[model samples]
Target chain A: MIANILDGIVLGLQFGLLAAGLTLVYGLGGVLNLAYGQMAVISAIVITLALSAGVPVLLAVALGLFVGGLAGLILDLTILRPVYRLRGEPRVLLSLLLTLGVSFIIDGFLNWRYPLETLSLRIPGEAVEILGVPMRRGSLIASAITLVTFAALFGFFRYTSLGRAVRSVIQDQEGARLVGIYPHRMLRLILVLSGVLAGLVAVTRSMVTPVDAQSGLSITVFALIVTVVGGLGNVAGALLAGIILGIVSVIAANLIGTYISLIILLAAAALTILIRPAGLLGVKE
Target chain B: MLKVKSLSAGYQGNDVVHQVDFEVGSGEAVMIIGSNGAGKTTLFRAMCGLLVPSSGQVFFEGTDISGAPAERIARLGLRFVAAERHLFPQMTVHENLLLGANPYRPDPKTMSLILDLFPRLAERRRQHAGTMSGGEQQMLAVGRALMSKPRLLVLDEPSTGLAPLLAQAAYEALGALRKQGLTVLVAEQQVPLAMSFSERGYVLENGYIKLQGTAQELAANPIVRRAYLGVT
Candidate 1:
């Protein structure tokens, strides 16, 4: 049980990395970021394509991340910005519908262009033992990289000029405008960061699972569940809640395998809703 | 200096402020007073570049800044402190204070000067602005506007929700700013005891200036007495 718990810590860290960016998008802008899963998919595809192109592996990964960010900017400019120009719930509802259309479009285009087998990358075979734990070298490495990156992002948001501008826009639009901080600039930043985060997830996913054209919506469900179950507008809270939920499932898997994991997921989600409808760390009105 | 000529503005083209004309020279104070639906706020919003006029122009500092973006207009040393907006409720009070100085970020010396100007804010500098009393937050809002070191300060209604003493204090602060050569334009329902604090004020009703004169001149008018001063 103790060993399994330790293993679960590593797993929890992975999910935290994957979900943190999505959570921040939701927290800062109140957008569900429906296309976030595509970030991971595209990152993986870019890495795979670079390898096929004879590019260096590290360069391929960096390019993959860049691809994700570019995709975020494109989505912001093309899809999200138009909807954002509208007012209130309609803005949210329209983006949800439009991004859903975009998901289908992206999936179809990827399917048409790349055969499913070409995109899959099996784990670079290696085991690394650390802190008395044996873990997949890729998972450990990605997890470590993610933890450090998120820490830096957290620090930036907590103590930087631009981050404060973004936070001001999120906290109160009029107040930000009162100080002459343009919400439009913050909106653009949101889109770019969304791409960066999505790309991070995509890179890690390519290493672990085969990404089919149909894979976009599958992981989105999990990210949504993580975001909502954590909180609607609190990134740090989403992390805590995501990791907690991650541990719950991992423990269930080690103790009872897949059967009990679903039960645990359902039960924990229900309890979370019953206890804190605003998620664990959502700002109260 | 700010000037509006034939300024006509409204929500959705309904024409609330009808061909209004006004000007505030440097180191001058102006006020607009009106009852509900008189379009006073709309005129203020329009003059400050928040609302675009339908068929008119606004020139600030002798530049045709009509239809300029609100943020850009703010950057040009004309700042508007809106009524009843509390932007960052969840952050610490210090955080809100720092944001006021953002556009002027290159000048930390201005920030200290701003703090010195509003000593009450400096004392509670570390407190969360949201938790502050209505009066304190209003002061913070105005102080934040001062961070930009605006040549012209436009306040919608500094007296709303404040006690008489607090309102007087707020007006006194405006007086001090005006004393230091900052142009001020205030819109309020209650006439200050002396408009001595302000050089001039205009009374608006039904989207036009019902009365305009030196602050004391308007204050002494029979119409002004009935409309605002409640003099029998």
Candidate 2:
């Protein structure tokens, strides 16, 4: 039971990071990047390719994260900014469709490039026992890394000028603009931040579970569920929701079947929608 | 410090402010007093570059700022306080004030000056803006604008929703800023209060400037008295 709980926490932290990225992008850009998972997949592929080419693991990981940030910047410069120029529901609708289209394009390209092969990061290390429960070293490291990243981000939002500008934009875009904050620049920075987060998740998760091109949709769906349950723009809430979902999924899978976990997650999402659409910590608009 | 010539602006195809012309000299306090739908808000929006005028020019300190982005215009030192207290309701009063100082880098002296100007805000600096009463929020919005240390400060309906005493206090704060040589342009519905502080007053009705003169001259005008002041 303890081991299962630990596993859930590990997975939950991963999910929380993805949801944080989703929340910021949606909050500022007013667009849900359904392609968010593909961005991760692309970073994972970059890291895998670099490792195969005999690059050191540390440099390969850095390169992969950079690939993610650059991809986010490119997408923002190309597609997302135009969609943002629109107002109201049409903007939201168009942004969704565009990201959906981009996701498909990425999937198609990756499948074409690396057909019939699954990929994973090979961070060679030995399993370690904690309180008589053996834990995979990679998973433990991933959890630690995730926690540190979240802590750093919390500080950034609280203390940095750019970070406060982001929060201000989240609070009121018009108010942000009035104070000489350019929404476009803030959007670019957020996309880059989100992309870097996706890269971290991709690198960490792929170390334990090999990923194929087809996995992006499922990952994004899980992220969407976690984000909706947490509160669309509430970062801390998303983290808590991720952990709760992770624990529940682990317990449910152990008692029933692996398929039951996904079902339970979907049900939880539906319950949130029906009962409290603003989410656990969502501010009512 | 500010000039508007033949300014025509509106929402959609309908022109709400038609061929309006005005000038505010440096360090001057001016008021545009008009009833609801008199296009005061629209005029302020145009001046701030929040809305692109269909035709006309807005010059601030001899620079044509008519079509500049609102953020760019603000960086150039003309600050606008919207009619609604547009505070970041989720953030603390300190955070809102910090953002007001965004165009210029945050400075301790400026923040201290703003807090001194409104002591109630200082007491509640850590409090979220949304939880504040309407009067407090208005003070916060104006205080946030002053954080930028603007050369020309434009306020839209600063007195519209405040209690009588709160409204008096707000104008008193504005009067203090005026004494500090900050040029102020107030668009208000309350004719008497606005005219009391302004050296010049413009009477706007249905998007046209009906009268412009020294505050005393317009305050004494027969039509101004009958229509606005409830004077027979």
Cα lDDT tens digits for candidate 2, B75-191: 888989998867899889999999999966788998999889999999999999999999999999999888888989999999978998888889999999899999999999988
Best by TM-score: 2
**Lowest summed lDDT window (length 10), candidate 2 chain B:** B102-111
Check candidate 2 and list the clashing pairs.
Answer: none
lDDT of 1 by residue, B1-232 (tens): 7888998899996999898888898888888777667887788777666777787888888888887767778778888887774448766656776787667673678677767767888888778777888888888888878777888889888887899998888888888777788888888877654355667878788888767888779878998887678888
Q: What is the TM-score of chain A alone in each candidate?
A: 0.90, 0.96
What tens digits encode model 2's per-residue C-alpha lDDT throughout A37-123?
Answer: 998888888887887899988898899899989989988989886797798789889989999999999999999996544557656
DockQ of 1: 0.59
lDDT of 1 at B128: 73
Which parts of model 2 have CA positions greater than 4 angstroms off?
A: A116-118, A122-126, A130-132
Return the number of clashes found in candidate 1.
Answer: 4
